[model samples]
Target: MWIATLALCLDEDYELIDLMEQMKREAGVRENCFASLGWLLHAKGEYEKARSYVQQLLNEHSLLDEPAIRLCYSILGGVATAFKEYDESLIYCQHVLKLCQKCGEDAPLPVAYQDIGEAYYWKKDYDLALEYEQKALDLLPEEHLQRSYIYRVIARVYRATYHYDLSLSYHQKVLDIQKKHLHENHLDFAAAYNSIAAVYHNMRLYEKALGYLNKALSICKKSLPVNHPDTQRIERNILRTINHYNRKRQYKVSNIILLYYLKSLKSDLPDTEHETCSILVRFLFDGVM
Candidate 1:
């Protein structure tokens, strides 16, 4: 069992499959093995395959145990969320929440809340998203390792509501918590930096935004190939922000401003600088800046 668990974590899907086959041949298939395999397949993004195993486990003749039932609903809810079926996800989450409450299993409460929050977020109900996320955080133990996810969800909700300051705050909280638990170059850290940069960009704090964007770019460059979509997107965002700020009069006067602008024909530049700053002007016109 421990070997199978390690294989799952290591993402050795073939090894996990072989181990499960052997287990099935030897023991006539166990509920725990099916559940574990379901999670493994889910992590690998084979949602349908995972769901099939989970459903088989749920149909077992053995009286449905509390843990098995909770896990089944949780996995089903996750699959629904993955498919962007938020309403269906919420239904399964509600079921899981009730089961957790009945069994006095506080450990699953945070997961249930987080799933519901995500469903609301996908539904564009920012208020409900924040409400459920906060409830999840309140129920979660202080030392919970997944606290970064809660912070990230709250940050996303705040961003959707146009609360840039609050969004930045929660993103920073996620970064701090992730830094303590994850490696410096972890993808999660890069995501947190990106989120923070986005809020700063929305607030017109170009320099601060560029700083975090660059950090995200650096991490992506080190950990991911240059052609990776996320790395390219981060680079593009950094370039766009730099271009926007470069043509601004305030940024032009800053010490960090590029010296090439100083050598350019000042008389030919637009009087208000807005005309020359294509990205910022576009953002303003689009009501995004």
Candidate 2:
């Protein structure tokens, strides 16, 4: 369990999945492997597969002990968050919290708080998000690596609320910890780079944003599956940064006419409008305005 948890913290999804699968094969469903697998699958962006596995566990909820039940609820909470069912996520996470309280286990308390914090974060309840995330952070020792996860959640909430400096600080803290603990090419570095890039992007530091995003993309290509969602997301982010940078450049009459032409095609080809525009922008401008 510790290994799986640590693998997740490091964003080592491939290794985590393999470990969970091996656990499942050895121990079957009774060892909480299914619950762990569900959670890990969600981390890998296999949401439908995660839901299917976890829903199966839910079907057998009556047979589960309190710890197993809590685990299942925690996994469900994460899946709900991925689906943007924030209210449902909160309910599940709250249930996990209540279970953790009943167990009187300090070890599990932070996870419950973190889960609730994430749900609130996605709901755009930044104050509640920070409140719960701070509770989670307070539970950990200052040097505990797990604190990085809480820091990341807080950092994202700060970013969303336009607290860029605070966001960057927290993200840098995550990097500091990762640098101390993880291998140089670990996927967590890629995540941290992507997050820092987002801060720069929001600050309108387009060149800095592109530089960090390219660093992140390079890391992803080396560490993650070629078709991984994180890799795809970084690719999309690069394109978006390039487009945003180009749009802010002084436009000639030809550029204005070209944009108008694309806009006019939206109504005529609604389904392909975005793709058409993106392709045209890349082709006509050679990725520069």
Candidate 3:
């Protein structure tokens, strides 16, 4: 369970899935592997699979009225948040908080706060997000793996608020901890690269953004499942950065027009069309696209 939890914290979704599957087979449905498995699928952007798992857990456990039952609610919140179902996520978070109130200020108390904060963060309410995240940070122990993830969230909040330097500082803290505590080439490291790239992009440091984006893409290619949404996102970021960089040079208008057309196609097309566009774009740019 610790291994699976740690993998999830590090954004190692594939590893978490494998671990949870083995744990479920060995320990059976009596354990909390179901919730962990559901959360892992949510992290992987497999919303339908995650929803089914959460539903199974809910059907089996919702009426139990135990502290353990709160785990089901927490996972429902997580899955909903992954799907951007913020209102539903908040209701589930409230359910978990009510259970925490009944059980005293135990571990889930902090987690409930964090979950609520996550929902707020996704809604672009950075102030409320920071408040709850600080509440969670206060409760989480210094060395817990969850603190690293919370730090990343806080970093993102800072970024969204336009505090770029502060965001970079916090992201650096997360990256340092990940390097110290997690295995090399972990997806969290890739995520850190992507976050920094976004900040650089916003700052109009195109070359720096491109460097971090390439690092992220390299890590995703080696570490994540093929065709993962995360990989596609990074590839899209790379193309955006390249297009932005090209916009400044004279004689680049034709290329820019082509790339802009491809971008429009990418936004409007299905995944199959996007894949075809990617191939065409690559052919036009000698694989740079």
Candidate 4:
């Protein structure tokens, strides 16, 4: 059991697979191994494989303990969320919430709440998202590590609703906690900075937005490989902000049409067209075209 658990601790999940068969003969070992393996597979993006383990755990004959069963359902919900199956994810998360009630184990309730909120967020129901996230926030203590994520999610919902000040407030809350707890080089700084930059972008505070974007970009360049998706995404955001700042004009159909022709002549890429289109938007916004 120690060896099996250690395998998971080291993130050598492949080593756990062979041990699972041998552990199945043991009393408590097999279930823990299964749960850990399921979570590992999910995190690795092996969604189908993770689903199989979770399904087995939830099967009628399994009779796994309440906490174990709840974990499996949560993993199932997470996998669904990863695949953007928010409706299905909500059902699984709801199941976990029910389990938490039945077992008198309220500790997992906050996580279930967060999962529900996240599902609503992805579904574009900003109002519902805020409600559920606020529930999670209320349940979580300010000192709890997970509150950072809840704050970030709430911030995102506010941003989507164009509540710029509220979004910045929540994002600042996250930063306040993160600065005290997380190391300076932690990847979360990138997310925190990006979130702040987005709010600034919405407010048309381009200089502040650009500053935060650069901060995120710098962290990504140091922590992630240049070709990493996260790094690329930050680069894209920086480009977008720069383009927006350069085009100081309101939206005008006339400018957009001109941008389309200019883009067609200059570059065929849809993204290239978009970059040029922002310039046209600026012309319209500034009423200079």
Please name the candidate that would achieve the greatest TM-score relative to the true structure: 2
**Cα lDDT, model 3, residue 138:** 94
Candidate 4 TM-score over all chains jointly? 0.65
TM for every model, in the order presented, reads 0.61, 0.73, 0.70, 0.65
The candidate scoring highest on lDDT is 2
Ranking by lDDT: 2, 4, 3, 1
Which residues of candidate 1, in runs, are more than 4 Å off? 1-33, 61-64, 141-143, 185-187, 197-289
Q: Encode model 2's per-residue lDDT on 1-289: one tens digit a residue.
A: 6435544553554544544454344323344344665666665677777777777777877656676677778778877877889999999999999889988754388878988898899989989998999899888888676677788888999899999999999998998887776666667778888888999899988889999899999987876555878889999999999887766664554486587666767666665766666665666567443
Kindly list the per-residue Cα lDDT of model 1 for residues 1-289, writing each as its tens digit: 6435544553554433543453334323344544655665554456786677677778873745676677777778888887778898889888988888897754467877887887889889878888888888897677565678888888888887888778888787787777677678766778888888878877778899899998898887766533655777788899888887765645444422334234333546665553445545455446454
In model 2, where do residues sit more than 4 Å from their true spots?
Answer: 1-32, 62-65, 251-289
Query: What order do you get sorting by TM-score, best first?
Result: 2, 3, 4, 1
Model 4 clash count equals 5
**lDDT minimum window of 10 residues, candidate 1:** 255-264
User: What TM-score does structure 3 among the candidates reach?
Assistant: 0.70
lDDT of 3 by residue, 1-289 (tens): 5435544553554454554454344323344444655655655667777677667667777434465467667767877876678889888998888888888645467777887787888888899989988998998777666677788889889889899999999888888777777666667778889999998988888899999999989988876567877889999999999888776442255476477656867486777867766666666567343
Instruction: Estimate every model's Cα lDDT from 0 to 1.
Output: 0.71, 0.77, 0.74, 0.74
Off by over 4 Å in 4: 1-33, 41-65, 217-232, 246-289
lDDT of 4 by residue, 58-90 (tens): 774464666677778888998888777989998
Query: What's the CA RMSD of model 1 in angstroms?
Result: 9.1
The number of residue pairs in model 2 that clash at the backbone is 0
